[model samples]
Target: MLSHLNNFLPRQSSLLMKCNFSKMFCFQCEQTINGKGCTAKGKCGKTAEVSALQDLLIEQLKHLNSVVHHAKENDVKPVTTYSDHFNLEGLFATLTNVNFDEKRFQKYLHKGEKLIETYLKNGGEKLKSVLHENGIQTADFSYSKPLKELIKTGKEFQIDLTEEKRPVTFTKELIMYGLKGGAAYLDHARLLGYEDTSLYHYLSEALQKLSLPVSEFSLESLLEFALQTGNWNLSCMELLNRANTESYGHPEITTVSTTPVDGKCILVSGHDLRDLKLLLEQTDGMGINVYTHGEMLPGNSYPELKKYSHLKGNYGGAWQDQVTEFAKFPGPILMTTNCLVPPPKKYSKRVFTRSSVGYENLKHIEGDDFSELIKVAKKEKGFKNTKKLALKDIIVGFGMNQTLALADLIIDAVKEGAIKHFFLIGGCDGAEKERNYFEKLAEKTPKDTVILTLACGKYRFNKKDLGVIEFKGNKIPRVLDVGQCNDAYSAIQIALALANAFDTDVNSLPLSFAISWFEQKAVSILLTLLHLGIKNIFLGPALPAFIDPSVLDVLVKLFGIRPIGDVDEDLKLMLKN
Candidate 1:
């Protein structure tokens, strides 16, 4: 049965068959151990067993996607809601640091197999014949195999990294990662009642191509598909933007206190605004003060969420700090999405996960009902007294709407040389010491320059008093927080609007990007930049391990993408250009 499965599965194109099997293989993030694949265990604390299970889940999802793709192509009504949402959650679960429970992956595997069965049953004989003719197997596969057997089967599907197959493997991984990011954003939008069937079809088609043999595509074609993933990601991000802004009024420049108030508290982490909104609604007047952590810090800027007086200020810094931060917190923590680190046993009992987030021994919230979470908060002692920090508050909510509202002032400042340059110095933040480069870059920018930031990376220097640039009696913050990583759409809109005001293109403007990426969402945003013909993006602290020399060369030559260097040198170069 294993051999039969291997016959139908996509294989790498390589002449050398020498195999050096490791315990596990994964290199989907910037911090993969030793700048290569993780073998013994994931740096994110994922075990080899969990890694294998995730790989297997992806393989099974590809098979299911093939059925959905062919059904749509053959004019059979595909199960849009089930298949699309399942695909989103399945891929998102495999992203770095999202889900770490082995049992959860097992359940996902079973659910995917059942989804394939449902799609085939709905398509009837005509759909099955169409799929079979296209070399897709419609036969049912058992996910009910024993745990050991399933793990063994999963190990057989580790990514192909042969020297001869690097280019193809790199391009395929790029597309897959972008799709994962897109799926994450789409899922957020879906939760807010925004759905685009075309986006769903595109995802199914892309996954189908990914399941095909390497020989079926050239490097050029795969690269094109990867860029298309970026193009669709732009649409996905726009959809999410609308879903967020429409559901909650557009974010405004608001001051959020970093200090905790005296009351029962719940620290809401991750990037889901909808989750935060729901929690805020449920916890209102319950004496539970909700504090934003990690990417949720931006939630305080939205009008609808801010209306809940109990929605207190932000708590910890970036996601990487959760282990220590979560331990010291006075109450329970709710992890709404990615960037979750495995909690130590000390505080594991106080942590709860929702949606696609999961950990082995921690409690999971099934739906909008955070009753148990609130109950846990009520049992725990909240902050006995308010504590003040050196930085009392930080300003956020410089999204498109807020920024464009000051367009005339910004344009006049630039024209008068009051604001000399614009720097977009933000992306996913990591624990690496080198990531400090972004902080330094932001700090060293000339006082005349404006810095635009998003995602958790802003936490690096968000509290710094960069001072405001005053022009024509108007004060504009030198450091502007443009919301979450998904809010890159707002950053792009700001740039386009500025370009139009200047009567030129974005490239011709005095704007530059120094991106600090650590995950797939950053990859999707990078691809979107490349799709827009943007150039000279400085990416760091390290390049992706999957991008071999050849692929890196293509990116450098085509998009002028460069790796981060000495902070002084990069800053000088950007200012000089």
Candidate 2:
């Protein structure tokens, strides 16, 4: 209904104007369009109204941040209840395909309005006038009216990203996306009971800048904010790394079974370890075997999680393959977080969402109660018979603590030329054919080279038997799996340790990043790399649709960023560098 409604109305038609649909535009993710942006419905299947609502929620967060800052400046301690966490949730909800339900966004908008009202009411006239002068009128906080009123409010905040002078908009979007990614990481850490007041302060400051009127925003300011976003992202990554490690023991290189055992099962998807932990506890001794799916695959590496014998190995390849994979999955599937696609009718009733993940009608776990899911799993026809294994084993774990413990061996391998180079071929995997570039790059990176990968991108070549090499009598796997996407933080740690051991900067190390990006999390990780001054990174399958050529030119000049070319050519180029 969302996509067809937008399609039926022709651009510039009277009906479009009457419904206020002409202001709609979305280029937030890759695969939007080569020329025309996705103005009606996103290629990822989000509707114009959904996109507009996302923008409205972001705008509301900015306003809320502005108020928070104004109250601080006036020495008024604005009462805090949900403002901080809500700011993070609002941005994360906007991430591609994370939350498509309009009702969910409506609740977020209403909550943000209440936070703003609390700030305004407590601050009195002085606070109100301060925000008004900064271009946030009193009526801007009126997001509580109704969904229709909120939908109409989206028009004024529209930035018209399709404008010919796109570099400015592009840069703003890059920073915003990074912020979204940062918020997601923050939320994860916060869930694990980690808190940093200063990080929250910085987040509010960044959002406040984004709340500024379009006329006041400058290319230079946005670019500066983008770099600040990079710094903030680094902190976010550090926080999540700490949270994950403290919650679970530091990961050790552990081999995970790719072959499923015959039993009733629940395929747990997405990136939330806490959700997976709760399900594991609830399903223990209940006869429902649980397997990690997609990003959740890395859960096997954690000692706290792996102790549960039923928390079996990983199932699918990547998030993009879920529609088919979920359908084929015989048992109930629980999406713990994002990176979810709409399931097919055959499996829709059996699929459930928890935490931040939500769909129009998919069942969700409330208060971590997965009893119904366990019941369904017990009743459903699961993997009754084991099939021939396509991928028998996958080497996971290899977090910072684990990888760094082998520093001396790695250093020795480099000195003796047993390890010629290190390639961090990591990031989110997509359905795009060009993603095959990563597979070729990994396959061709000489046997002596150690390939360190994290996130779903590892699926590109993870199943292949890239024979191990012996270093100091150690059989080191050529392809090292470094946990989930958040584990990119661990990869960063390994790079730093390698740099420190060699008495040189990470830039001077024989390391390169050939990253495959699809969503905001990848953007945040890339920014973290830039913040650390690591250069000569190769990025593809097609650069983001939001980046203008001129802006990309700046990235190339400043960071030595290059697009991935022919597989062989890129391989040769990386080696030569």
Candidate 3:
């Protein structure tokens, strides 16, 4: 199918080169229409030029990584940080709805090229072999050129699908998406001062492999790369799990308020708890309050972070509702990481980005100093009075440590037929109305069943009264909040413990996964599940746009991956099976 589209590339490329840009072919996120690639514009409001610049930036990352790989093979010390930094930021920038600024991507591409030039200039005979090994036919030692002149050459680096089959391309994209997601998690861990040099080494090697010609790689090789992506993502998750728990202590089971306080306030969103910790520290005794929003809601569960009195509670739902929610938020909002949508004019001035997150005309904070945000918060009319969005507090912090402690009771309840099944239903959430399916499924789940949820997806039904069950004189909440998306590691741990207790594999247990994915982090999580041999996962609101029909068929046959059916029917199917 992709080859057929490339038949007109001869004419298309000519026209694109003349215009100094080309059409984009992106379907990285779940919102892609009809599950086909977006040609003219991205569903997330990204333009062709921005997508092209992102691809160009990734291409340069590949080049930078190949240089490092070549240098390492030749036993030469290289400025590997050049490649390492880009590997983290560049891939993160390409995540769905993360960065839409063409100029930012252009700067990254230029910086990446200069880093490559430095490698070539410093490298000798060993560098030559390195370049050859990375599929570079020739080398130019010149680094003095206008940034535009170099950026214009980026069109030559755009992804071409004439040679590779669509399924293979889809698999490659799947693997790359997983790596991008893993890199985002790794970045968070790095911010907390955790480092894994071996993981970084494998990451560069994988990026270098992406630089090789498509014709040289086979489907089998692509499959292996996808599996390796899962392996690396597992390590990345483990590293983050350690970093988060060691720094913040294991998450404790607690109820978080969904209300606003009567004072000047700052709303901190995204997945970074370290930023939240910093903001909470600075805001302490300042007469201003701090609140969590979106994925940051789980921050309320961490023992270290939750100790702050100013850390009030969660503000909004998921990232999709930010446009309307941020405006209603009277105080300043700080987006510390990904899942940022362009703010509306009404609230654009109130939104600030930090760390790899960026948008045009928005203030970008460089460090822990959130004074600007504080000033803005002081100026705005914050919650004039305390108002509760929910009468009852939402439960959170049911991580592996907390869940495993109840293993004996859970097992005994299962034996006594008090607990029927466990459904792990959560991941990234989106704006699609079809996502209501998750809400319905969760609402309809039996009272005797326990629902394990994580990430922003839990917001769809977290506020509901799912009721509690009593078994063997122990009380267990029906819905368990398993921390943030990264805490899917906790879910994995709980599953393993349960499987071990039952003397069976995870797939054989009375457990099911009904996952909702909107972006690459969900992709990484799904790959990790596959790597663990878990099967029959029901994924929606829609399958990824990047997957070809044939490729999806292969996944279904091998892994029992299925799309969500009607809420009632799917719930019944999960319980019956």
Candidate 4:
């Protein structure tokens, strides 16, 4: 089937990207509708087989979501933060780069567990019509499946190892990976007593429905789940935004260092703002410095986080660089969430996992055990001070409250020609060589441009000397580092504001969204962009796996989305458009 579409595939995608799905149709994850963009193989590592399975899995999840949504809406069990947390784990597992630790089957198992429980009460005979069964011998796999099995089956839903060919090159796989990050973040927020509305139910429902056998599910239904996956993730991040702001205060302009002081220290990374907060408390005046690493750089923006005297500096660039950077840092690292690549043996023992983040042998600090971290900090020497590395006291904690306060001024400045463009140059970061395109793109963006970035993607150029812009007496470079990947919502809001100010559509604004995607968070953000009808935004370094040729066509035709090319070319295109 892909052979026929080969004629339509981009010349660059002229590789062996075939996968068996149906007799007449072969899918390489999310290929372009007419085969113009989806490289024959999924940009994500999802195999041709896993590509097929994902469709089926999402089929199951949609069916499951229908029933679950109805139940929750009807006030059946009254889903809470806990349920949403677990839902995030499963929904995000199917996302690209996240949850690689668990098997794809584990995801199915988790979904199975929920389906069985829901089915037992609703009865297989009655709901079986609406709910497609996997045809397994187990009477109630979703109901009777053990906790371990839940995880195993859940991972199966994550991706099929048998058919999920390696060398994961498709964007779908990375999108899946990103979903896991979002899932983990959503899960953590739940653990800390945060709850989202329908997003949780939709996630569980999608996961549960994705298990349906081919004959039992419809393609339209599958597509619905995919979009719903994006929609729900948006909700999850919205909750995260609220939780982060209300809990840690909104992110403001602040400068953090990649260098740590020579003294006892704890390095915090991932998107868990709360964990970082707690660590800050635990290390307060305790002779331990808390160094932010990877995604944790945004933690410096929160007033609640900055108030910590020991919350010192950042270390390294992004998550992928950890293998090398962690080796040199003289402190214990606490990974609060996803993007945890295998640590080199030298520093593996020094790593710690809190909450749902776990590795096979990596010691995890669970329940409330800072004793291990404290002991290590006392034993090791952290950076004495960050005098040489200090970039200046950047104004950090700026949430919507702060941004909105400047709304009038920002609008006036735009009117006065001081601020010509608002560039959202952020997205997920990866180790891929193609990623350098973003660095170059950022370098070439106009000097008058105000950059709003978030996620690990910002790390690529955050350290660059972009210089300051004149904004209402403040001469700070317009490069604003918003918080984590999910915080893209802030960017969206800003766009909407500008649109309203100009009395025009969002696309009519002078702002350009140059996004770099690596995982599901990017996917969700992209979906939200489409949902809002934002168009011609540049996306890179690749496309997703699950986007079938037909679906990609729909995206391009309906939303005008495109993969980013050479930075110079892309910049010219953006400027012209």
Candidate 5:
């Protein structure tokens, strides 16, 4: 796919030469070009133009947020419905691998300018006075320049140039990344008609803070704000949890097939349940099998979704493997959210992006109308027959509600020594060889311990038959799939319930987090853990490149967060503790 992206290269190279800028500077994910940054084409296939445009979009959002913040402080509430949704969508579009279409960022940039105008117009005199009193001049949100000029302007706002102090810049990126993750959750909830004004308010406040000069805040103060971002992300995740469950019923323990059945089919990837539900509704009884990929695997566990017999089963693993898996998938594909890899030409025409997901050449579904997507599915040659595979099935759907239903059994087993410890061995998975640490650690976990897994990271060892733990004739699966990264709230609920049952704090319980992070959502989840004061988390394959050494030291001292070491040593330490 990247080799075919040469058409974008000449223009990108010209932009770099004219502006005297590096090709790009993005290190927003674990798989950046190097451990430092992507100074050429992005490892995720984002062109330099799109990368810079996204940076400009972020700066534009910060300026809009600053205006909204002052308007609210002056007792004027700007129309929130549009601004809130736009802010989230704008931020979400910038997440790694979410959107690579320069045109989409250009559209978002124009929309952001309009939103800022609306807020300023609604703010009137009182808001103007507040802005003047604070010496906070509003930014000119004009984005009418040519694409090349706009890309050059965007270079001025790159992460590296955001703050003079490295630690301050790094901390700011941390908060910004957390906001991006939180926005993803909030956006999902909003799509389901669940709205939290407080979460929206926090987003504006945080973005407003980011717009300020580094001299206005200390590293310690910024660090505190990062935790606050985490606290709000918890609330955002809670909102999404309610939206998903109340709308689709809490996920029940389900055994989903890894093989496909004979029929025309459509594969839905990414993390949006609402889009999946809509697609399912549209495809009912159409003889088209709807299979899930990546984080969408948990959709098979939803009562509303699984009821449809045509909703076949998952057909692929994590997002990282989509390049190979998607090509083999004999149907149209719908990417509804983040973690989208650029598709190769072989299946690029068969792929379509919906919601915030975008790739320049792929077709995009607008709104709830998946008619075009369904049409392509019907035209494509889907699986002629089910392929035989060693891993035929996997169990999922152990959400908070489902897990809580088995609370008595779990607690009794723990007391009876059938279960010794709980290991949270999941997060965002990547293509790095170091990620094998998660698989090895899971494989080595004692039978007396139960492993809770979620997100794409679970693809590391989810297929491995870890068997079950039996207590007084009651058998519990050794591994529990706790849904998507969006379902982290469910895992947190399980932990809180267990802590209450054991009469101890979560840190005191025999629970260890061996998190494998790849993107911004993982960063947000980490902040939530830190906000809860959860300690001794083992994070890998590598820490965020944006985290300055000094800022990392602060996190290490404050949160007891450490990098994953040898699997044997880490497992021994976790078990011994």
Candidate 6:
């Protein structure tokens, strides 16, 4: 009788995939090593090959970093140093679901080939020669003797260079993923003509240091990187702010729709503002109406974007609901980033991905090319608008800059007890049922409080019939949609404004943060909040599976980062304590 190999296999394989780079370490992403990595492929379907390629990308980036640092110090000043090289749109492709094209990866592989010439122009030739000789390009990690470990474990607060392969841990990959999102966001802003050379430099340094082997540094040293990331994130947001304002105008306070218009329409989701602008331009007079979906809902608040004649109302609900909404809608959908849950088979062909968003067999729009959207819309016979009851019109454009300008009114509300509390009830939306905790908390909160929100989290209570309260002679409702989760940058601003007005530290203010997170973007925002020394923040519905027990302890101990409990209990806890 043939033996069942399955019986021989470990029911739950835990072995890390052998590193293709130096074979010195095993894959920490743990998704591709002969069923050893997580017992299944990763959520993004990253394989051992992709993991190795990613490491090589990091290795090349570090080589570039060494050159950039050396050249900057010695005044070598190469033409295409790490700053420009690292910011390629390729970084966006590496983010989960950003890109899945094998063809595209090959193109990037070629791009990686050219990167060495650029690095050579800068400062690290010795490293470049070793990189060339090392069979990393053809054979992934044949040199398992030692890995050129970047950010070594236990060294915590240090960035270093080494040829020793440090073991890759799950947390290390998670951190790398966060850095990738930040780097990608920073890159897009640079592409938009908004320049922050310092951020570009820091991003490269950060990316290079992510997995590098290092010696040691204190908590203070680790905080330095986190703060530096914060500083750069500030720079990124500023750059994005400038780019958005210049391209689409500063989002003015305006009401958007949960209801779709009755006629042919298109729903655009994700945060690619440039792609949105391109869509507006293309569909302007084409009889095809455009509607913002998910993060794209804020696009309607930007003045220039709103001016698009064909830009109609929003469609459906949060991204998690898109599988059903997009299926029912008789139109094409354009997704620019994550918040992409796989659409059902029926509506698959009608969707198009721009930038890093990809799904197998779906037509993905690339480059500055948004033409695919127009063609798909034509083929789909335009949208049969599915309209729902209109919710009360609520304002959206309270971005950090704009909200701070309204600090006086907000301050007055708190002083007069017009608003007893400020609840930062926002975060990424997911299909998980546990997310109902957000809405439950919202319902349970006092009527005298204000719901300050951003991102897809607003989908929970944005349509609720909360009566408007007269604060400062202006009748304002409890809820405010402050753009996307990245605009938690705005939430922080509003808090600082209230604190400054009240003359107390931000934590001392009667403000509570209850967030729902499902992805790395949310993870980065949480990290940003922690970096700011904010406390008593409640996260839900579950902490990331990647966070080890030790790391979770540190988070809870240092920041009081509690996971969401029962709504009644959490609300009472927040109110009483």
* Candidate scoring better on TM-score of 2 and 3: 2
lDDT of 1 by residue, 391-453 (tens): 459899999999999899999999999999999999999999999999999999999999999
lDDT at residue 425 of model 6 (Cα atoms):
93
Residue 363 displacement (Å), model 3: 0.2
Better TM-score candidate (3, 6): 3
Using lDDT as the measure, the top candidate is 1
* TM-scores for candidates 1 onward, in order: 0.95, 0.94, 0.93, 0.79, 0.94, 0.81
lDDT of 5: 0.87
RMSD of 5: 6.0
Identify the leading candidate in terms of TM-score. 1
**Candidate 2, pairs of clashing residues:** none
lDDT of 5 by residue, 1-577 (tens): 2332233234222312222245678878888754667777889898888888998899888887888888876777667788889988999999988998988888888888887777767887667777867776655436867778889988777554433477887788899999999999999999899998888988988898899978888899999999999999999999999999999999999999988888899999999999999999999989999999999999999999999999888888999899999999888999999889988899999989987899988999887899999899989988884565545698999999999999999999989888999999999998999999999999999989999999999999999989899888888999999999999999999999999999999999989999999899999999999999998899888767778766766777787777787899889889876
Clashes of 2: 0
Alpha carbon lDDT at 244, candidate 1: 97
In candidate 4, what are the lDDT values of residues 1-577, reduced to their tens digit?
A: 2232343345334333454323112222222333322323344333334443344444344545555644554445543444454455545445542333433434454554565465436544444433334333324333234444433343344333233332222323333443554565577667667865555555565444433334454444444445555565667667777777878776666666555565777888787787887788777878888888887777887888888878876767798788888887788888877667667689888888865454546777867657788788787766666566645333333345556667787788778888777788898887777789888888888877778787888878877777766877866466777667757767767678778888998888887888887655666677667656688877766665445455566566766767776678678777764
lDDT of 3 by residue, 132-202 (tens): 76567435522234545544555455544543366676677888889899999888898899989888888
lDDT of 4: 0.62
Model 6, residue 467: distance off in Å is 2.8
> Lowest summed-lDDT stretch of 10 residues in model 1?
6-15
Q: The CA-based lDDT of model 1 is what?
A: 0.88
lDDT of each: 0.88, 0.81, 0.81, 0.62, 0.87, 0.63
> Which residue pairs in model 3 clash with each other?
none
**Looking at model 4, which ten-residue stretch has the lowest summed lDDT?**
21-30
Q: List the candidate 1 regions with Cα displacement exceeding 4 Å.
A: 1-19, 124-126, 387-390
Model 6: CA > 4 A from native: 1-38, 44-85, 121-171, 214-220, 343-345, 384-395
Clashing pairs in 5: none
